[model samples]
Target: MKKLLQTIILLFFFSLTSTVSFAQGYKIIGKAIGFADSTKLYLADVTDGSFKPIDSTYIVAGDFRFEGKLKHKVVQTYIHTKNFADRVSLWLENTTVHFSAEKGKFKQALIEGSQTQNLWTELNKAIKSSKDEKEQYVQFIKKNPDSIISAYLLSLFSTSWGNKTIRDLYGNLTPENKTTSYGKNIETYLALSKDIQIGGSFVDISQPDTSGIIRKLSDLKGKVILLDFWGSWCGPCREANPKLVTIYNEFKSKGFEIFGVGAETSKKQWVTALKKDGLQWVNVSDMKGDKNEAALMYNVGQYPTNFLIDKDGVIIARDISIENLRTKLKDML
Candidate 1:
């Protein structure tokens, strides 16, 4: 009995020591099953439509830890496993967060220790349980006008909700909420979305190719040009490259062309990715990441976005799925 009592006491102290509070930064203590030791996991900042992996760690004995100081006050992030085979979103701040899950079940993990995450989880649960998700979402925003989560949600749906709805939601948000990066993106989307409507005249862009020669959108005037916006850091973009290649190859002989605009922060990374992905098409960028002039003109908040321009340079389709694109090409080509 005494030995058992001593063991329990040791565990109690160990638990206390494991989660010591820090003056600044965050600590994530995690455990998982069904993963080998040394399996790498990545932490990425997913805030404001950006996908930047800031850190990574390898699991050891089903356990891992990540703690670091933020350059600024960031509120949200993502944990990616197996090069994004699975992903789980979390709120990040100066606190200790606990995570545990079975391998391949990261999407179901509870990111505990963040108030914002708590609210996010609660709202998601309510939305999932409710039949009228849109109604619930609207009501939540109306009630929580002061919450940053509401601004985040409004920004997320700004594309689907249209400009008027985004403006209404944005107006309802508190001043503090309106100052976030999400809010600014919402404003930008509202402004830029007006000119880039379906069936509208395609916007013209000019940027330097990997060889430093300028390329213009007008160059592909008579071809079915796909203006693809992607990034070197985007896992989905990299994964989709092979399929893109197949599509390009199948349609290139029939007056189809892919004009890829890489949302790259570094020229080296962009060139390397181009080589690795074997994107055998005209790719261009300003090496300014998302701030590329073309990216801004199109309001490209996320990667893997594309515009489909017909022979006359009219944007006939936007963000169509690969299967739909194939079908469309079959008819048009």
Candidate 2:
């Protein structure tokens, strides 16, 4: 009786743990990649934040099926194949995902979900409006004196557009124009006001590793840190990895270190890329794209960007080249 009771208790505990694990969500299918003979299906947990991959299965004859609990939220589904534009779907509940394309050429895209269509429509409109607002602000700044609106508009352009065009325009503004309210607003926007760049000075000292081990930036105060933002599947970023590795090896012994922050949603992909690229450095990823705290804090509008911080945690460079990075590091070291 005692042994049977213990067995039941163990099973109950196991069931509870499994339920909790599935709390984030479940999926029947995920990313499908590779050619016919080499095809494979990926299963992912939706709520893991970093979109860490959970499991994988092989597909045969262009058909695949797998089962897992569904979590509530929108998730991305990609079908990757060579010689063809990868098929993508924004999957939600109560719908079997389907794909169709023209003969011999699978590069075409077709989505069947009404909800997904609606979402994309709204997104496109927002993008158009944002672009229009940017243009209006530029012309408005040229003629008007500085005001809070002009300052805010400049911030919007830099943070949203993520280009050099507006910054260049601001620089070319006449000295007489600089004296206007518009010029002052632009200047204030470029320089971080006390309240705006909150906690920009304080490095996150209490962030825990994947293992829940707490580590702080100040703990490695003497090291030159390269805060890298990248993604596993990004081809350009992967191209840059080899160069970064070379630099890291050269300067690692000279008080230099790298802290890579990936935007990959899958732990499996993240780990695979890390090993494949020979990235022997500390790394983390929230897997949430724009929802990442660091990305929001730093106003990262694009991938493959980085900040070089000195030993004292002061940002020394932004969006620079490998040659420039090497030169800067040599000076610091």
- Top-scoring candidate (lDDT): 1
lDDT of 1 at 311: 91
Q: How many backbone clashes does candidate 2 have?
A: 11
Query: What would the C-alpha RMSD of candidate 1 be, to one decimal place?
Result: 9.6
Q: Model 1: per-residue lDDT, tens digit, 205-323? A: 89999899999988889999898999999998898889889999999999999999988878888999999899999999988676566776776667889889999888998787788
Residue ranges of candidate 2 with Cα displaced over 4 Å: 1-202, 205-212, 287-290
lDDT score for candidate 2 against the true structure: 0.58
Q: Any runs in candidate 1 off by more than 4 Å, and if so which?
A: 1-45, 48-74, 79-87, 95-104, 132-135, 219-226, 229-258, 272-281, 287-312, 317-333
RMSD of each: 9.6, 16.3
> Per-residue CA lDDT of candidate 2, range 1-333, in tens?
999999999999999998776463433432233446446545443322234464556666555555444443344444333322443333443344444433334344344443543444344455567857555566655653333233334544554543355466676565665554444544644552222232245345234444445555567666888878788877888999999999999999999998877775567787889989999977777665433455544656577888777787777777778989999989989
The most accurate candidate by TM-score is 1
How many pairs of residues collide in each model? 0, 11
| Stretch of 10 with least lDDT, candidate 2 | 192-201
TM-scores, in order shown?
A: 0.64, 0.48
- lDDT of all predictions, in order shown? 0.83, 0.58
What TM-score number comes out for model 1?
Answer: 0.64
